[model samples]
Target: MSDVLKLEAPLGDVIRKSKLKAIKSIVSSFQPINNDKIEFKNNEHSDKNISLDKIQIVANRFITIKRLGSGGFGEVYLAKDKNQNDLLIAIKFENINTSRPQLSIEKYVFEIMYECSYIPKMFYFGIHNEYTVLAMDLLGPSVEDLLNFCGRKFSLKTICMIMEQILRGIEALHNHSLVHRDLKPDNFLFGLGMKSHIVHLIDFGLCKNYRHPLTYEHILYRTGKTLTGTARYCSLYTHHGLEQSRRDDIECLSYIIIYLAKGFLPWMSIKNSNRKKRNEKLMEIK
Candidate 1:
């Protein structure tokens, strides 16, 4: 299996007529080295639900300090690296028994996106008993939190600064032929404490490469891609069940900028009991 998630793409006139050599030339403009191969280690332990207070990640002794969040996948904790002057890190724990692929896919994407500074720094992945754990640099509050704090809006200067950081992150992703289908204020987080001005893009569960590696050909566009991102910020193509491309990310970011400026989207109040109806209404509003 390929490291990139396999999704059906739509066929379009532009994609059909694209010259392979020209596509390869454009891809060559970026500086991504091919390192798609990833291998994960499994821990030989009996306990599946790893208790942070009782255990530590192997290789590097990252001691758990407190739980940050938890959901169906597992728990995320704020931990300290005992060997590194109690350096803070975020560790996510997932039961190895589950069939969910979030942990594996996330690790894969992190490895491919490692060179991008705007992306989060992944320290390592390990197993604690029967749980698979991923450790990363702890980031600070998201733009969503900042928007709420400022009464749902930002000053002109702050908005410009934030958008510049976001565009840089998106450019990095596109340079690697990857498209971040899901984009919103919650996914763009500022670094914590001393790294405050630096913004990091997180959450890769919905990320995928949009071009073939060997041929550098654009993936054919496809339909029936389920709603893969936040409803309020999703692109019109997404609402229409069309394949998302690089432009979709830019479009979603534009919506986010509008939200930062106007507090809320005009379609925020539109509601329909049926999900499809809601999405259609959103498209109409757009």
Candidate 2:
């Protein structure tokens, strides 16, 4: 068994908060990115579908190896950088014609947070044929994947270590006045190779700036809006359609920690076939 699993109590009991605070501020420059200035051109041929089998090369550099996985945004592929001695990378493609395009915002977030420890490095962002493509550092399995591998639960010490990194990641974003609207186990992935122990926050498709970049003003709280994240892990405020702030992100993280430690959540077993009714039940139970 690993030493991390041998521990009985949470890591926070041993680590000093002051030391963690110092560590969290190690990444300098918390300047927020201006959302208004960034502009992405709509692909005129966006009506055409993206066929991965036909797309061997993207942006004339990375060569697609195979699809890694997919989500509501689009598909991710394992690729190699031919110009960089076949350096492996992950490329994500979002259909340009989707009702809600998120790749542009995701790319902008990566650009602004390039120096942050918990963020993946973005290499290329542009339109490829009919899809908006983003190439970045290829990461390893998600926490969800590892949780399943570990029989759906994590040791207390392991959970503490994971939450520490996750907290840092969320702190980095919150410091920049941004909120990751979608916070779930699937979006928290492990780094690759020697950095495998490090945790990275991914899938910023639903990320939003809760405060104005220039004025540093907080966004107004409103309700009766549609939910933005995975229903199981989203916070109560989010399920109720309120504008998400940093608190919602932290609330979702708390749910994630509990689920990792307990192997399941109370709302995970809801089986109402009607999606609307099921979400209503989830909100009630959650």
Candidate 3:
């Protein structure tokens, strides 16, 4: 319910004149996810909307296997690297207009924190047809899934372990001048199969750099901006339209820890209440 305004223009178009060149800035910054056997076949239908049956190749390297999930931005599919031992990866396809900013932002953030053990590695980012696609390491089930398996609550020992990893991830992110606007159970994943115990922070789609790129000065505060991130875990300052800072990330992390420890937040049941009533109830809970 924050009032931050979002412009309805392509980020590449707003920031630079040439869309391809602007996108190339990120593409040129990193190596391909798999370069051994890239084979982008010329398809007359490349620009058409993507479907599982319709997709054969992505960036000439990964082939679609099945749809994994879909969100407001686009669809994610499980893909296999054709040249590298058929390595499994997740390919997220988002239409240019709706996904450009998020894709670009995520790539930029990954460029900064790719070495962090708690963060997923971005294998590649590029445009196919009219969609901006990102290929990243396929991770395992989220902590939210783990919570469900444990009957909606985490034991103190489990919560402590998970929180420790999460704190490390947050520290790594902050060390690079980034703030994860959305830090929730669903965004933290356990490694798949052999790497199960390793927790990774995923989905940088809502992350932002709190410091200026060049000067490295902290971004100044702004008010009345539209709310970003999940309402349940958003910092109280977010409710007042204040810009998110490193502290907000920590605050949201605190809320998540509280939820994991208690099973449910005190305000969860009153989420549907009117704004005034909700605020009053939340204040009482505080």
lDDT of 1 by residue, 36-98 (tens): 232111111222344566655555588877676653346677788777788888777877776
Regarding lDDT, does 1 or 3 come out ahead?
Answer: 1
Q: For each predicted model, how many residue pairs clash, with residues at least 3 apart or on different chains?
A: 7, 0, 6
Put down candidate 3 lDDT per residue, 59-130, tens digits, no spaces. 789898877765434667878898778988877776676412345666776788878888777888999877
Tens digit per residue, CA lDDT, model 2, 36-69:
3321111112223455776568878999887765
Q: Could you give me the TM-score of model 3 versus the true structure?
A: 0.77
lDDT of 1: 0.66
Candidate 2 minimal-lDDT segment of 10 residues: 23-32
The best-first sequence of candidates by TM-score reads 2, 1, 3
lDDT of 1 at 275: 70
| Candidate 1 to native Cα RMSD, angstroms | 14.7
Q: Which stretches of candidate 2 lie over 4 Å from their true place?
A: 1-4, 7-49
Give the CA lDDT, 0 to 100, for residue 82 in model 1: 78
Q: Cα lDDT of model 3 overall? A: 0.65
lDDT of each: 0.66, 0.70, 0.65
